[model samples]
Target: MNDADPLPDLDPLVPSTARVYDALLGGRDHFKPDREAADVFLSMVPHAREAALVNRDAFLRGVQYMVREAGIDQILDIGCGLLTKQRTHEVAQEIDPEVRVVYVDKDPMALTHGRALIDTGQTTTVVTGDLRDPSGILAHPQVRAGLDFERPIGLIVWMLMQVAEAEDPDGIVATLMAPLASGSHLFIVTWPDTGDPAQRALSQACLETLGNGWARPVDRVLKHFQGMPMVEPGLEFVPRWYPGDPGREVPSAEDLKPFERTQIAGIAVKP
Candidate 1:
């Protein structure tokens, strides 16, 4: 293990953002506190589970696009929660066997669970790192060893930016992205606070209970990736991007309306 990667003490009574997410995704890697928090959120907003599933499905689409269309062979999945379903490495390496991936998260349980579930021999590694410290993540021994900083990479920040408000989300993104070479792509999924007042309240309650996340509007979130050129159907709902098939149907405004207030997703490239 790297010196920067320290094992954190697990608190079973407190609901971690990652564990709450795991419970939402129908995974059993959480404690009682996590389940209680998830249940409370669900009670407030019953559609949350469906929304999470949709976001996850859309995430896979983005990853597949990066590997098959964008020709990206390396990926850095930051804030990667517990390895529940189709993971970054599984999707990327399936397309290209030589693909290398690094999963970074601050949660020790997530790191430990990921190690147990994922095959490390395929140049895939799970390391403890905070997204707020972009410099440390970019320079971590695991990241430096597994990924080529000089080459293009698919950077996935799914529902991760929600955790950092003090860091100035835009600056955090910019700091990490500045070093990657041109052609590098950024895939982001954010939970934008754009719903009805009641929905917003529910979202806030969920965050307060689970801990360490905030919901921001899509336009405000887009400002973070100022210089990067977005792909077609830019900065739309997660379900809106390449809706029916990878290169097929383009989702309509009506198609996006359902998920509009819940989540937003986008893919941009460094020019």
Candidate 2:
């Protein structure tokens, strides 16, 4: 077995962000540390976990749009937590089972789960690496094995960039998206500091304690995907991004203000 294998000596005492998210999403793979961390974020805003679920749902819709509308079959999902139940590859492959997916995350527990669920790189791979480091991420054996940059690829950086605030977020994304073909697509969801007084207050409180990284403004957050063609109604709250369920109402521009909704999402085409 490879030394980085996820099964052995998994650290339960130290918090795993992916495991923490798993717990938050009502999954059973988390430890006490994960639970405690989740509580801290949740306490700040009762709707914290709800926001995550909403964002995940939007991600599914966006992936479907990429496959059905844009006809993109290759996906590179950065920060794919735990590769849980309903995920990027699963949704994308439902449309085209051969859709190649490369999941990138630095969590050992997430890597372990990926190994158990996704067997090889023939069409899908779970890679262990930090999203902040494009070199290691882009050059990962699994990413190279599954995706061809010479062809169009869909990039999904969902609910993850908050950890990379110290690094140049814009530059990182630019570097990552630079090599894709013309029809390639980039999808991003950022936890912007919500504009609503209560939401912003709550998120601010969480950021103070989490200290994982600082939050960003919505405009600055959208700026991460410059030089890409952001289609109509670009960069709105996650719920506003291509909703699969027609019954869902897009949050009003007012309700989506900072912290009111945790994710600012958009799908942009590489022109």
Candidate 3:
């Protein structure tokens, strides 16, 4: 029932990855720098906006499956960006109204906006935390209280590993899941290593310009799920995981032409 903690400072000049993502999703909380950065990405791949939506769809579908099929009720959404119409809590709660969700993000803006737009009751809450500090995040008051680590929980990491290298992503994943009892699940949705040359160039451009973002092959992504047992339909193009589901429709070959290799997603459960 407590309010979300105060967020850190906001740096407008620096192009925020979160804001750029928000802009890509047609969200209204971005600044000039975010738009400029997003435009740079669009210049390389005009379908970047479509790609973003595809990723969102994949994320929502993954959460829905976890809640409805996996029988999970607690979720930890790491690196959750600005508010969106179909957020993690929204999707999970739709399946199970009592589902408890804890939204975590390093961005101060995300924390502030999440409280205002996402958190509506005791079942959901927002906290300011960094991906680099997985231990801290797991130990946060909100996370500790909102979730029962002794039971199963869903951990959502959408496009976050691309930003982490020092922590040995596999190690980070292990560290984060160590506290949770067996049966917990982790969902990872991120840029795929395979894509059009133009798409690769655009990804590099964003890295050079905004100093964030990276893409890895599916094999590399699987490494992060090392100890966890793969959920059915192991790593594949995000849309391919659970195709034809309401929010997770797999586009026709023609509709997927422009973004066929844009993103990859998978879910794995702790043994």
Candidate 4:
């Protein structure tokens, strides 16, 4: 069997991808190298920080909605970044006590820290697995321990796909969602290609360089939900999905211009 590549070290001097995201979200686990690289990212996509924060907000909202509103008891959070104080399980179980959450990340450090952040007496768990191999994560002990696949599970793939290459993203998502029955739903958020040439080019290049460089157009993104039924708001900007009263809404895609840069969000159910 071909084992996956080992996770990176705690070399704060290297400025890892997750640490860069941590810096963007105002987290403290990063160092000078991460800060420097993040600064470069900001310069390339000016609103990169804002987009990260907005994306976090969307993640919290999605978990809350699924747990409280959708009655989803099982949740699998893929590519979950550094498990800081603000955790998905912390947010979701607050609404429904029986909620089960499994945090999956290819980073070994993330696995250690995420397990640490798991509150005692809670159903939350963590595992080291890559998104490219969805079933491996599903078969992980932590995933099996916390979740029941026979029931509907809410799959949260937040702000993670932009880091995946184009040739296989849709196929990857399909594989992940394939396990769930008809009621299972998937939530995905990503940086989209805006009509603004300058913003689009800058955002594309930055993601391409830092991430996997495969940000897709909205059309390609919609293709991810090819056989699913969309929720009320459908797939759109991350900030626009069922925002609270007087929420932020971009009337048109153009109106959804990047504040320097912006990310997109979508939710669809398996038919």
Candidate 4 is scored at a TM of 0.86
TM-score of each: 0.91, 0.88, 0.91, 0.86
| Model 1 root-mean-square deviation | 2.4
lDDT of 1: 0.78
lDDT accuracy of residue 58 in candidate 4: 75
* Total backbone collisions for each predicted model: 0, 4, 0, 1
Each candidate's root-mean-square deviation in Å? 2.4, 3.0, 2.9, 3.7
Per-residue lDDT of model 3, residues 158-178, tens digit only: 556456576567777778888
Instruction: List the pairs of residues colliding in candidate 2.
Output: 194-258, 194-259, 195-257, 195-258
On the 0 to 100 scale, the lDDT of residue 137 in model 1 is: 91
lDDT of each: 0.78, 0.74, 0.79, 0.71
RMSD versus native structure for model 4: 3.7
Per-residue accuracy of model 1 over 1-271 as CA lDDT, tens digit each: 5445776778888898789888988999999998998888777777777877888887888899889989999999999989877988888888998999999988878988887778473579998788888889988888888888899998987555465666677877888898898899998887666655533754675667965556677777788676688877777667667622446565665555443447777889998
Greater TM-score among 2 and 4 belongs to: 2
**TM-score between model 3 and native:** 0.91
- Model 1 residue 194 lDDT? 65
